[model samples]
Target: MKKIKNKKIKLGISIGDLNGIGGEIALRTFEDERMLDFCTPIFFASAKTISFLLKHFDIDIKFQGIKTAAEALEGKVNIVNIFDDKAQIDFGVETKESGKYAIQSLKSAVKSLKMGEIDVLVTAPINKSNIQDDDFKFPGHTDYLNQELEGDSLMFMITESLKIGLLTDHVPVKDVAEKITVDLINKKYKTIYNTLLKDFGVEKPKIAFLGINPHVGDGGVIGQEDKEILIPTLEKIREKGDLAYGPYAADSFFGSGNYKNFDAIIAAYHDQGLIPFKTLSFGKGVNFTAGLDKIRTSPDHGTAFEIAGKGVADHNSFKEAVYTAISIFKKRKEFKKLTKDVLQKQKRRPASSRRGRFE
Candidate 1:
């Protein structure tokens, strides 16, 4: 496949929890010089943090530290320090200090993103519990991205074979059912549908919906949500000239190999979707926040505090996150070009020669 951006795309990296594996996996990802051939990476972190990781892990890679994205060099890992002396790294533990620094890194990268200084963003993991402050009251990264970018983003999990989108992310299990309304369902469906086509290059994407209750409510014995809410929602989606099917039992859908026939799956809640996805692609899945104006992706795993400084943290998912961000960036650009070309052609056609709207 072609590199996401023909002209070197600038990728912004946000350090997650400084106390965890965010810096370790991030630094490890760029260890090889060949990584720069595809895109320029700017780490939104402090020199103190990166240097600490380097010495702690005993890594020998050098990175360019710049004040702004404009100074990012081609074929080199760049660090845009967002914190200085106030920043501290405490490996294998989560602290308020780490959380504050994580937010700082994210805010810095977000500024660069808004200025159009970076093409894509690949975030490291953040401890949801620790990262919560007045500035970050949301549950996690997806919430922050949605609020900042002002888009109804979906927690779209991607692997080589399957893509799963969640209806309600980071919600309590008891509140999950109450959150599933027709409007929310339809909006999420539309976002996932458009993302599949524009960001993933999937034409006529097939979306499968998972039932909320066991055996799809067992014909109202288990629950009424499947028959009452989700079924009607899917019908409405299909009527809009889109291919969507299901309200299928989640367990059977994946086990029966039925998901392979679909382009994406829409799960009712967080665990309902992520559990299966992680089971299948645990070490290599990329969590992509779709429907936002800017591209943002992250490794499927969390901080992995237990193995923070061990230098044995698996970088597969993080690596794939970077690759996926690049791919989506390229696909979106191409989709826009195709759309513009089509519009231009329609405009160039003689008015009288054009057929009626229905025709």
Candidate 2:
């Protein structure tokens, strides 16, 4: 595959559930003219829908409408008209129509991302219940992207101060214990380890794993999964020279400020990690889907149906998601360049000289 140049990364924006606050937060984010300097945003939604939103919110911003992602212009909010017909604006109601339009926007944006028309994607919030159909059977965006994209997906929730990765996201609490197998641990650990190096530029990442049970199964008195499953797996991981630590008590891990000591934390399930992460960085965190060949991010919070179209939804998280995607995209390019140069140098070296150096 050909590499896209780093200058003015094409950021694809998917307008999530129409009835939700997806449109509002997206528009609010790009209203600042300075954001155009970092990337050219392409909103995969109809021009009519965007116009309705602008008028409803009483926000003054002009956008250039286009039929395809190729026609996107720099320094202007560009909308790729995915549909010509107007979508009904129900404010806070969850209808089948809203779900249908949400998936349409998402599908269009993902297509552009796969074709290399967009360098990265920053998705708005989607209602998981509403946006389900024959085409999209996955629980959430990460699952769908995992199938569409190249590598194993890790749902990484990040902020400047804290970073958390889920071992099993979108899985029920009852099923989380069974999903924490040796293979799953190794796959997730490797993904996060490499992501830290290539995506976040961490030289040697220190990762902590939160326990599935309370107080890490209370030293096997409470449960044996941590003692039997997690302990053995972590020991094997350590033997391989990875900086993996802990089946630490999830309850006290964050309150004790131990999270600051590590590069990232891997939680056994969804709520175990997100609960603490949102508590700490609620409106500022970015949900980054790591370990994939393509880059995708979303706001930490979900579609606020209660606050939808109220003009009071906070756009900071969505804004941070865009910034995070851009930063990671640039970092990945730099990593590829550095690695490519090293490979070329190694290829030029004599075999006898390389053997002597290893000796």
Candidate 2 residue 275 Cα shift, in angstroms, is 0.4
Give the poorly placed runs of model 1, Cα more than 4 Å off: 1-6, 349-359
lDDT of predicted model 2 = 0.91
- TM for every model, in the order presented, reads 0.94, 0.95
lDDT tens digits, residue span 53-166, model 1: 888888778889899987898888899977867476778888998898888899889888888999899999999899888778978899888888857889999997999999
Model 2 per-residue lDDT tens digits across residues 1-359: 99986568899999999899989999999888899999999999998999999998887788999888988998889999988689898989999889889999999999999999999999998889988888889898999999989999999999988999999999988988888988999889889999999999998899999998888998789888899989899999889777899989998899999999999999999999999999999999999999899999999988899999899999999999999999999999999998788778878998776521100
Looking at model 1, residue 181 earns an lDDT score of 95
The lDDT of each candidate is 0.89, 0.91
Least accurate 10 contiguous residues by lDDT in model 2: 350-359
Model 2 TM-score on a 0 to 1 scale: 0.95
